[model samples]
Target: MTATESARPGKRGGTGRGTGTGAEAPRLAGVPLLGSLLDLTSDSLGTYLRARGEHGDVVRITAGPPGLRTELHCVFSAEGVQQVLASQAANFRKDNAVYQEVRDSFGNGLLTSQDEDYLRQRRLVQPLFTKRRVDGYAGAVAAETASTLAGWDRAPDGVVDVSDAMMELALRAVARILFGTDVDTTVDVVDRCFPVITRYVLRRGYSPANFPRSWPTPGNRRAAAALDELYGVCDEIIARRRRDLAATGATGATGSGTDTDTGATTAAAAGTAPGAVTAPGAAPGEDLLSLLAAATSADDAEFDDTELREQVLIFLLAGHETTATSLSFSLHLLARHPELQDRARAEIAAVLGGRTPGAADLDRLPYLTQVLKEAMRLYPAAPVMGRRSVDAAEIDGHAVPAGADVILAPWVTHRHPRYWPDPERFDPDRFTPEAEAARPRYAWFPFGGGPRACIGQHFSMLESVIALAMILREYTFEAVDTEIAVSAGITLTTTGPARCRIRRVDA
Candidate 1:
């Protein structure tokens, strides 16, 4: 069957279970004992693609040596994705080995939390990401983007590592918006340790060997050290924010003297120590840290310091890393396709007339938004979402046994020919209202879907759009490498530094 025909929502064509028909899913045969773990560790995206190609949308992949101790049901079809992420989400949960790995580092933060705790934390955090709250962050996003570009201008070489640059920019942006304090001490520590921790965790998670994090293994030690540093940083930031709130007698609510009615931080409350680049109009309580610190659940249950640290650390890491990856990939794509870059630049120029973009300008920059959407479609930041079946569940009429790992891969679904034609092409127009309206909801879920979807989705999109506009406004990027190579871990990122030659655009 053709890729197009096979990818249809309910089409069944492979050596696997019949789509929409009750049948046992086909299992991939691998070497005795190891199963497909080696293939997965080496090239996860390639493995999934090959599995879906050969075994159909839903395939059972066994892992573990000889005993086949673990089985993962890889779901590629939109129908199956909806089943796992939405329709039958109650039957799937985050308490799986994959999330346990995340929890080992992040604790019971929103991403790794399950059940009642998840719902309570979600409610407490949801208000902070509302459209109004996210818009308040636009100034910091633009300021940091412009500041980073200025530094690049003074660099000895015109060549820049787009990946590192984006990561730093995103880190600073998120720090400024979330911390509202001179978190340089914390940011510096996080910047140094974040990569080490993520890389170590990814390797351990994918490895067939289930090494206990408590083990004295070299990788575990390094990851533990990084986690310690991160925890220390979170502690310092939380303590400082508490001190600031106490000094001002602000409960972090409106009219608290630390923040305006709009929740913008006051200069004194913003913790602008010498050399600190504070976000203008920001207040002490305006940031997420302060809000979280002062927040209470419906029952008035407050988060203790450790819980607070977990949430803050997770946000700092997740907020920056995911957006940075997306921005790097977006820049790489634009550099590779100069025509699209020019078109995006033209749209930015027409909309802002060279002024730095603000949250208000976002609605007007449809093409730039489309460019970002398209880039994410091609290289989704969170390539795969995993859940464990709480009980036996039916996905596309195929029975998924309890305790099985349910994998929904955006990387595969986004490129499925039934949902996206000429899927490999860089076509921003594919995100046009008409085209998007024509596809199923799960066809391109870069930010995921359902109640458990990314809480920072709005924040991420706004930050990326602002950053892309600011960068494109100031510079025209030229690809220095013939090809851009990417690697997937906790998030999808470029394998190495994405090198690009930067040229200042004429005003």
Candidate 2:
């Protein structure tokens, strides 16, 4: 049973403000030497929830041993979440080990850059994500989803892996939008290589010490090979974009994978950039890659060829993976609940009525949007996000040391009994405007919070809403895999196929 709504872990303040005075955060001790390492990595969702339930909103988890131990300050309260991510965002920077590894692999794009560098990058790229701008990409989402539904039509016994389907749909849609028609070579390279690279990052990120990349160990050699391929393809693509920009002189930004090992720099025979993109695509120089390559700062600064590659990689990773996670989980959740599925499908059919969804359709289909939001609340794309405390800070009166690692677990926060009744239950009604207005802002921050929030949020919403609305409307899906077991890496990857059985609504 949940505690009363007013029964907070401790004294609480308004949004982003924690009420207690200076004190030590409750320490969570675990297995000898490894501390909480085994419990956390094995099942972080359960671990974080148990920690909050036993200790309070603010718990300290120390992992590793002696001089090599890492102290993690876990903040679970909505108020503390706001404090760490919004009001006191300046006190927390993206200097965590996992993030550094990300920057090393994906480059210092908006997701990792901080301070002045972040501000300049934000300024240059923010305009491209505004609602008006993102709305223009709906065609890409619809086209890709239409293709996904068609592929599902060929599935044997009406069974399809929605997880793989959503992942492919999101990657292809974002990639097409980003690179336009000339990106046939990127999709496959990214799809194959991202997993190899991220797995290495997750392993190295949590270790107390690591062998240098220059070492020719098995892991190092494999990662280096993946990096070489990934970097070479993206570098070629960047070079190609620069060449194109110099010729036609237009500007902006672009994701997804391809099927061939052909490099992205060179177009296929007939000078056509070949791959799988077959939709109403963007005009010349209007694709996201072109825009980012052409973007100039207020001070007239622009991303160098290297910086452009970095930002491009980040866009592809952050844009498609998170959106795909949300979409997959959303469909899986609805499949498990027939009533909710019917309600959402009815909403889609009433609004979309077999016509392709448009950017304007986002508003006209509010109930379906709520369904997506509900799914996200249960399984956030970024289940666990990390930050580093830059200075001593007070949260609910507990003092955090400078340079300590801080964790803002949205997966746990979204389940706070104070805000969510029957926290584990799937209920889209919890997201109605009236219900949303009643809660604190940070109570459900899946896209993160504060100024450093994911810049592609609008793009994500557009893609998810359009895709889900379309998928649900066209097909009647029943859950084949009722339980979704997930393990977190860079994003929440389902442990299995996350399968569902789909039949045409007309049948």
Candidate 3:
């Protein structure tokens, strides 16, 4: 029963055990040794749905090592999500064991850190998403999209894997803006370790305990090797920039890779900035790396080079993968629904009018925005968010022991029929401002909620819109086959691969 409904003093001893709801109380079966394990591992959403249906919204099921009870509440209810995220947020902490399982490779950047460290880092990094700062990123987003589109082959009946296409676009966009490097060149450098990282993070059997480091699993070894290479690359770039800036006598980490006399280029790599660069109309450039390097915490906390690399690596891994999944799934939906695709394309064309999309265009492209929102609702990359109670407390009148894990799942919430109409269908209109207003605040969270909300949210959303607009403006896509099944691993992606046919559209 909801906490509010059961707040009255109970006449009986030790508070009432009776369910506030008129329905019979759920009974835990003594049999089925593997029931909870199977439920936790496979088809977790389905299991939650059934439990909610059988009992009420806040049903408890047997989970974890046998007899080790854990509270599995369905906060899909708007009120439930709010209470969990905002009302009692301080009571929650990111589920460490689960996050550690995923974040061990990336190190404790924003995504995995908690308490004072997380807050300090968040404060240092928050300004980068400010209107003035994000506005600066628009030109880069557009340039990357336009350049990526120029290389597309749209032959008659030519098929392209939209998912793969988006992966390429997002990785490159993030790389250029965040690290100031041509991502296309670095994709090979980083992607060599991508599969292994993904496997370790998402694989059901991924337990750090049993998996011996001695074993030469190629992916694991590759991932370790890749980390070394990534660190080396980051160090090299920092040293080069530091050297150039010193040569020019620049106060901060500014660029000096150019000759003022002849406007002669010194750095030969294509797309690399000449010592320093500026945005299309801005005075000077400040990429994510530079900004992080420049930031100083309120308490005088400063990030050294190692900390900087850790956060940047976190940005690369978390930011790129999630945005790619969102775009990929949205494209898959667009291909399936021709009417929706046409509507999105028309919206983009009308708003952009053949000129490149700008920050202003984002505000105008409501339909495109809705399409992305709905797509992310259906396929939230980080579907489940959890926290462990530091001290023993009652949650919705249930005694949640201090060590217990409290989970709030966006996947189940987005698909909760009570809130989402036709929960499983690909319906973009549901995300209209009017429609969204009818739902609860936490009902549609894709970047999660509370103090720990994904820091790269604005960046990701901006990237998705620009990328989609660019692709739709240049190509008309159709689902070559609608039967392709999508499965969830680390990210909600096609079980096999996302295949689509594209033809260049006439401007």
Candidate 4:
């Protein structure tokens, strides 16, 4: 994967731009225009490595006909990401080609919105993710994990796809905390609906045209039905909560159960609590939804139900899939390298001495955390982040014009030899506090950076730490697959089943 081997011999020449020293940037001149374009859609990382090896960190690609204008592709250093994500950040906008499709399904959520809308939505949702609120939900997160794990077949002969299992686990856990404690009961419904929508998004970037109602495309029909069912479910829950508020003037919703109501009814039920909390039948604790429903900007503006639903759905995907992918991959890595897993377990034992991890325990479980960090560094779930240039600007001194897409990939960045020492190796100690402090800010961005960084990052980390610790404490995992192969879709995932054998830990 080194630059010299990847760069084509004759296609090497210096592009007089950026800070690159006289090294020639990789170019594929004789290849048909279609071939280059196909390479972009088909093998982005391969294209990036060639460019990086030839041109240094930042390299540009021309993917189409000369008359049509070439697409701009830049794979710069961590410092470049910092520059783009910071000081000159306003020049970069999130309206990318792939994300346009995501926005159609997710609506104007924080992840999709730009400018004023982005600022407003971020403000409302930020408070709910405060350290205190996140910590408060830890017990509930653990309880849900335990509940899910309780159902697993722990016998030696039983093999499970830990990736899929963790995806289901994460989806249910986040849904319960955000929507209601009983949301896990609907994981099957989510599984049924989400795949259809995600597949549609993957296929059809971001088009608004509705499919023919008569069209029997199973995916399309399923997506439409799932959307309707999800809305119906949310409305019904909201309505029930409203009814409960009318019957009994209550404010506190204990973590024991769920309240089904339309959001309006939930608000009505909450009434005039000092902090503007949700009704008794609302979610168990103050979740992201409740916070949005309760928030008002300095100007006293609030997000409507549509806005709330969009944001909630965005979190539904973000809060679950990406982290779950990382978790599943980490487990895959642990299975492949049992000695590494053993080292992590020994560290966990020395730190906690046979007890479930608390908030404080996260700091003590440094190696386990490092392992997770290394796993993500290599196999980032959300591999590619794209931003379209709204204003013509310079990215690492290359003239990037308006309307062109700019992509920064963690998949490439994490593997870049300049930043990552022995990039391909699965070494967790590299993420030690001292090691991290020595690296540039953007060198390790598993959850991304800037104002747009994933808000549920803390939530994801807490979930991962707890889940990994619990699994390590109870069982030992070994890989059954010959070699792990990754596929890129909505997130980076195993090409096939991530099968693993589990053996119970004996006292």
RMSD in Å for all candidates: 6.3, 8.0, 8.4, 8.2
Writing each residue's lDDT as its tens digit, candidate 4 over 1-507 gives 000001111111222233322333344442664335556556656666566766677666666444443445464678767766675678667665456667766677877788888876766666666554565555545556666667666534668788778888788777766666447545666777777777677655422234654578886677778787766665555444445544554433222113222222322211222223222223433444454455555553666667767776777767788878878888988999999999998987787565556555567788999999998988888776666555656666555555655667778888888778788888888898999998888998877788667777877887788778877877788899847777566677566888888877763
Q: Residue 213: error of model 3 in Å?
A: 4.9
Q: TM-score of the candidate numbered 2?
A: 0.90
Better of 2 and 4 by lDDT: 2
- Please estimate how well model 4 matches the true structure, expressed as its whole-model Cα lDDT: 0.64
Superposed by TM-score, candidate 1 places the C-alpha of residue 303 at a distance from the truth, in angstroms, of 1.7
Task: Give the range of the ten consecutive residues with the poorest summed lDDT in model 4.
Answer: 1-10
Query: 1-507 in candidate 1: lDDT tens per residue?
Result: 000000001111112232233677888777777777677767778888888888888888776654335677889999899888888889777655545666788788877788888877776666666676667777777778768987887755789888889989988888887776665776788889988987775655555456677889888898888889888878877888888777876654321222223464333222233234336436656777887787764454667889899888778767887898889888988999999999999998888774556667778889999999998899888877777676776788687776666778888988898888889998999999998998999998887777777878888988899889878988998898747776566777677668888888983
- lDDT of each residue in 1-507, candidate 2, tens digit only: 000000011111112233234788998868888788677767777888888999999998866655676667889999999999899899887776777677777788888888888878877776666666666677667778877787777898989898898888988888888888755678899899989998888877766678988899999999999999988988887788789878875544321111211112111111112123234445667677877787774474788988888888888888888898889989899899989899888887787565777777788889888988999999888878787777778976687777777787888999999999999999999999999999999999888878877778888988898788878877987999999888766787788778999998887
lDDT of 3 by residue, 333-375 (tens): 8999989999999888777666666555667789999999998
Pairs with steric clashes in candidate 1: 33-65, 33-66, 264-283, 265-282, 265-283, 266-283
TM-score of each prediction: 0.89, 0.90, 0.82, 0.82
Report model 4's TM-score to 2 decimal places. 0.82
lDDT (CA) per prediction: 0.74, 0.76, 0.62, 0.64
> Between the candidate structures 1 and 4, which one is better when assessed by TM-score?
1
The superposed Cα distance between candidate 3 and the true structure at residue 37, in angstroms, equals: 2.0
Candidate 2 lowest-lDDT run of ten:
1-10
Best lDDT among the predictions, by candidate number? 2
